[model samples]
Target: MITSYNFYFCYIEIHEDYVKAVMKEGITVSPEHNDVLLQIVEKHYKNIPFVYITHRINSYAVDPTIYLETAKISNMVGFAVVSEDPKQKIQIKLEKTFFNKEFKQFDTLELALKWKDDMIKKYRD
Candidate 1:
């Protein structure tokens, strides 16, 4: 498990098949935050399709517009955001339309990883 605090509000963790990010409570997650994540993913893992899993542990706001530019990254084959919040669930539904890659929300990390594995296989095939 690789871990680093890219920003005081955001902590980045890398796994074998994906990256898990945790943000400090109530911070607005914007394009700048997404940019840092993309750079980290590009720098550590290469040549194989992988996932960006946001393990939401705190209340925060996200800019759905970032999805447009995020979709343009070919290596980012899927996005798995794990959350159990009802309010965030609604926001996630709205964000889905802007995301070009496979996107889903889950209640647990195990399920999210399973979906990520399946997506990677699907895209590679």
Candidate 2:
């Protein structure tokens, strides 16, 4: 477990080549949210293409405008979002126009993790 600190809204796991973030419910995602994520990336992941996987397990509000700036983060190569909610899926579609989500929304975390592995494999090869 990541015992560094209690990141209330999100719990993150740093993989070999990707970061998986599981967001909590009833929260709002804003520009400030990126700061925490970036800190993790800077501390744990560097000198490599950055991949982000978001497991949306609960309802939350994400600022649509923030996606643009989020894309500009250094070395951001890909993104994966997992959610079964119809509303969230639609939002993901809208988000696709701004970001390159090679591994888009999946109904389950297992499927998303598989896709992340495939992405790493492809990147390695």
Among these predictions, the greatest TM-score belongs to 1
lDDT by residue (1-125, candidate 2, tens digit) is 33333488777877767788877788888879888887877787676776788888878888766777778766666788888999989988887787644638899978877887787677667
Q: Please give the lDDT score at residue 29 for candidate 2.
A: 84
Model 1, residue 53: what's the lDDT? 89
- Checking candidate 1 for backbone clashes, the offending pairs are none
Residues 6-103 of candidate 1: C-alpha lDDT, one tens digit per residue: 67878888777788888889998888877887777778777768898898889889889999988888888898889998888999999999997789
Return the number of clashes found in candidate 1.
Answer: 0
Q: What is the TM-score of each candidate against the true structure?
A: 0.92, 0.83
Candidate 1 residues lying further than 4 Å off, grouped into runs, are: none
Native-vs-model 1 lDDT? 0.85
Candidate 2 regions with alpha-carbon error over 4 angstroms: 1-5, 101-103
